[model samples]
Target chain A: MANDNGDDARILRLSEQDNVVVLIQSVPAGERLRLDGQELVMAAGLDLGHKLALRAVPAGETIVKYGAPIGSATADISFGAHVHTHNMKSEYIANYSEDDPYEAEDGS
Target chain B: MINSYLRQDGRKGIRNVVVVAYLVECGHHVARKIAQPFEDREEHDVHVIGFPGCFPNAYADRMMRALTTHPNVGAALLVSLGCESFDGQGLKAHVQASGRPGELMIIQRDGGTRSTVEAGRAWVEEALTTLQGTPRVDMKPNELVVGTICGGSDATSGLTANPAMGRAFDMLVDLGAACIFEETGELIGCEQYMADRAVTPELGQAIVDSVAKAHRHYHTLGHASISVGNAFGGLTTIEEKSMGAYAKSGSAPISGLLKPGDIPPKGGLYLLDMVPDGDVRFGFPSINDTEEIGELIACGAHVVMFSTGRGSVVGSAISPVIKVCANPETFELLWDDMDIDAGRILQGEASLEEVGKEIRNNVLAVAQGTLTNSEDLGHQEFCMKYKRFEPIGPECLPA
Candidate 1:
């Protein structure tokens, strides 16, 4: 369930294990925050559906969602950093692995 | 109570419909004027279905004949411009032979649009009267042939509703019923895995060949992205997207492969190859959901099981579309639009098998003439753009 603040701001939860939170409504940088009984400071501007990391994460680590690894971090991400294309890549895919199945001549 | 009207072909239908069919694009406007006003009201007697082509097409002929003879259609009103190459008389004869009343109205000869609309209304009213007297019988679950398709797919689709529907498809197939899964374009990466599940070696190779054809076809059209939502859901490549979309078929053996308008011969599990066979005459494979449903129904699917992660609110012209919502949050947001909630599996409130049984039961209920959300809301979306497909080779279906 999402609640609208006095000025019409909303929050969305992507997954249970996600340490981040998504704003359904845009919020200014340095906005006060209260989530899951934690008092966290906003590190940057937040847009609708963008994630804010609740805790620090390392590079090359997998991002869990629905109790499964949806993708892995492309770079070392600090707490409350937005998790998106700039830092994450799908785990079910191979970027440059030699085992790339599509590259096979006969696709054995 | 489960009630059905049995057709002359020995198939049972949940609803008795009176189809006002237009034979050519020229007759569409007058036919629509006659059938348009009857649009959302469920008198269980009035509905319009047609194919728009001025030229003769064998595929269109077969489809019109099959649909007019469909158990759900008790009678049909054929509107023709009188000059088009479509065999209006032959189609009427087929409908009549199926023990259903068929009437043909030539718009050019009937004193133009006004007179034809009046005549068409009278014909439909008479057809409805005849359909009211048709006998209703009990329908069996095992006698059903259901098809499943997923659109607006995202990451959650593979993990949830698709697998749930797969479980239901497996159950139906085991109960001596036939199940069809389609959209070969969305099935690129998992072709080998699916081929390996074929009941026969030839069927396995055929599966591989069909997927390859689909890959080439989509590539030709520059539609390798599969779904618009694939990009939104963070998918970058065709294989990653295909791997997620293929979860809807479950572990069922690949029983056969069929072209767009081809129906399965005997039925265990069949794959409907939706790609064009030749030099891409049709613009896109399917512009939207209704065209796919129309093709599925043409292939003798009694019901269509549609899965969506982003929530789609659509129904077919002839058959019912049972929507299974995949994303848990999307399900919550669009709860009223869904028929089954496969997202409950994510919440630990329901198991995959439990949701599967619910989906199967819903299919049974809808087959018995129960209306789905889209149908209830009057979503009779239909579109049949041009496409060329060579008939399936014998190797695609093995006896």
Candidate 2:
């Protein structure tokens, strides 16, 4: 029962405890979002293939993708503040952790 | 109903090919000349396959031997430049050992190009007549090995085409046929999940370690972004892309993990690690689609199931590639280029089982000698580059 206009928009649950829903299609600013059969006004524009917060998130919280924890957030993120590189960091070993002494010494 | 052209080795080939193989690129002209004589034959089975390098290496020798004696090949004419590092005589002997007729037409010793061409033509003509006389047999679906790969992927790849191939792979594996899915670089993040689905715990660890090896290989080489399409389609990290790419393997228990050129031990899900084991040189793992197909053939694949959202047109020298288009829009744009429209799954026009059934049917038909789009277009491109692979660890091959 998702609608693009001012009508009720259906929200999708990516995971059981995930406090977010993915915007299957684009949603304009000020449009009302129907989440868990409850209506919540959109705080901002949401693009397709992007996620939106289902509930208010605290500063330094976890962000998930594909129903798995991708990384944590740095600052207090609004219900839909585009959880991305600016907010989340990789849990996998990458360039961000390039300064470890063990890595530098192993030199493999 | 399943008609197959039987080869001399008692193996049935989907196609009977008069393989015109050049020992080295130097002898390519003579090989082409040999193939010209049988250009208009009823079987229409002239294919040009060769290695450009004249280097001595076990990998190269093994690859050439496999290609020359591939299932689709019924007869061969090896055109050598008379002084190359490739073991031309050994190739001929191997071909002869398989009971298929093979002749070494040395360009330097056979009076140069023109004479070699004529002599090559005579050789091919004789080989063809002998091959034509081989009896046709009935090939069963269980005896086939179908490998799948997805290149030029985009957003729709996972939702439509990849899952569609997974459904088909499930059907193929259930029928007692072997199925292979590869490109370890593409399968980065889902390693743990995939390994957990392995038939044995040891295989699961191997799957995880294989991706770890690939991550290290690509990271060290600084070409980690070879998966550019995923980023273009809005994937942020390698793990995200890996999660998506791993779906192509379906929900089947991975029977084994294999490196490039290693055939599946038995028919089940196999992961072919496309990245080189150490140091990661050789320019790029695969220059294009044909190189991937060449590697699949080297690993004993009779046919490959190619899934693509962006669409691909290349095929292999010894195997028929069944292109499965993942995007409905791409399929609409390139319908002729694709063999199966997996995009229909998204439109609700076709169920996952329907497309899966179609892919399985197409595999059987192709194995029975139906030419695919790549084959019809004469895309006989081949490339096998140099690389060193430490044998896959015991965990990877827990039989």
Candidate 3:
């Protein structure tokens, strides 16, 4: 279980191998966070439940979470950057789009 | 000790319900009207479940048969539209063979909706009276089969509700109960890890092959199972969603693999392979949550534990559903529909073990005759559609 701090902790790291930590609460841009005894400032406003990079990840590298690969980075990402669709893509399937060829008539 | 209705097949039921099923969409309205009177009556537990497809599908027939003879159902009233392709007679025969009262009402021959509804109601009333004298038997935890499915999932799901469900499943399996977790499409990336937990190497390979089949089928369809709501909830990729969804299985060893309607032969943890075999004839494995719930009940699940981050309120037609809310915000908005506040783990108020214990207790309470949140609100959502699958090999269910 993740630590239960009253208001001091704002992020949760699921595993030691994970390169990202999930935010428990939203943080405003420019807010300084002292996570794992390391000080870092938010480059942008982070939404609640979103991921923040725990370390620098280069382009084409797999993003690890829960001790497994979730996806690969599309571009070089710095430490503390938000790790989402803009920087990563699925390793198993191609990126999704509305006009893809496999679109069914029922649109399931 | 828990008291349950004893079926002639030697299975025990948590609820003695009279199910009114429609063979096609044409008979759905008549079946609903027949069940309307018993909906408000506490003594009579009548539910409406059906397949709406006009085309004949063997999988649909099998599921209907499984549901009609389900331990929870004491009697069945099947409604048929004379022109539809569904096998109403076969379903009726199968139900009767299970030693339960079965009746079929044809709307076209019974003089349209009004006359058919009147006749169907009378038959159901008689069935309910016969069901009232069912013998009660002591139920052991080993005789119970439980299933878990996650819906409307968000990031908090992996952190709280899903893992807590995993803990509860582990506890159930430890108590010599049969537990099942399903939806292969949602389990994309974790195939290798799942296979590693199998009791036998052959079963492990079968688990791997099932996920591979799902990958190809979904790839050809040009869409992953990850929905737009999932993306908005901060899930970035299919693998992320898969990992979260896989947590509901907990740390139990995989005892066997089962296709839809295949009852587990023993007390242990099993995986329901929802992905169809052969070509992709069916557009999707499941159209929605209710379809999967229907399949779980077909496999003899007495209770379903549904974990949701976006707050789903659907209860199954035959089996009872216990809702576990993952998101603290969603829990605040839909407290009336939620049974356990697993979001308390996210809010730092409770541990995952505590929530898991709550879920275990709730499962036993529901089996002992407590109406779930959705049941109290009269939410008996059900759906069935056409699909095909090859039979499982001996390796998939090794002795």
Please tell me which predicted candidate would have the highest DockQ against the true structure.
3
TM-score, model 1 to reference: 0.77
Q: Can you write out model 2's per-residue Cα lDDT over B339-358, one digit (the tens) per residue?
A: 99987755546655678789
Model 2 chain B lowest lDDT segment of ten: B225-234
Which scores greater on TM-score, model 1 or model 3? Answer: 3
Give stretches of model 2 more than 4 Å off.
A1-89, A94-108, B36-44, B226-232, B346-348, B351-353, B391-395
lDDT for each residue of candidate 2 in A9-85, tens digit (9 for 90 to 100)? 33334345566555545578898766654566776675544556666677677665544454566667776455555
Error of 2 at B171 (Å): 1.5
Query: What interface RMSD does every candidate have?
Result: 9.3, 6.5, 6.7
The parts of candidate 1 lying over 4 Å away from their true place are A1-108, B40-44, B226-237
What is the TM-score of model 2 when looking only at chain B?
0.92
Better of 1 and 2 by TM-score: 2
Better of 1 and 3 by DockQ: 3
Q: How many clashes show up in model 3?
A: 0
lDDT of 3 by residue, A7-104 (tens): 23677665568898777677899998866556788888977668878889999999987667889999999887889999998886422232333322
Model 1 chain B poorest 10 in a row by lDDT: B231-240
Ranking by lDDT: 3, 1, 2
- Supply the DockQ value of model 3: 0.24
Chain B TM-scores per candidate, in order, are 0.93, 0.92, 0.97
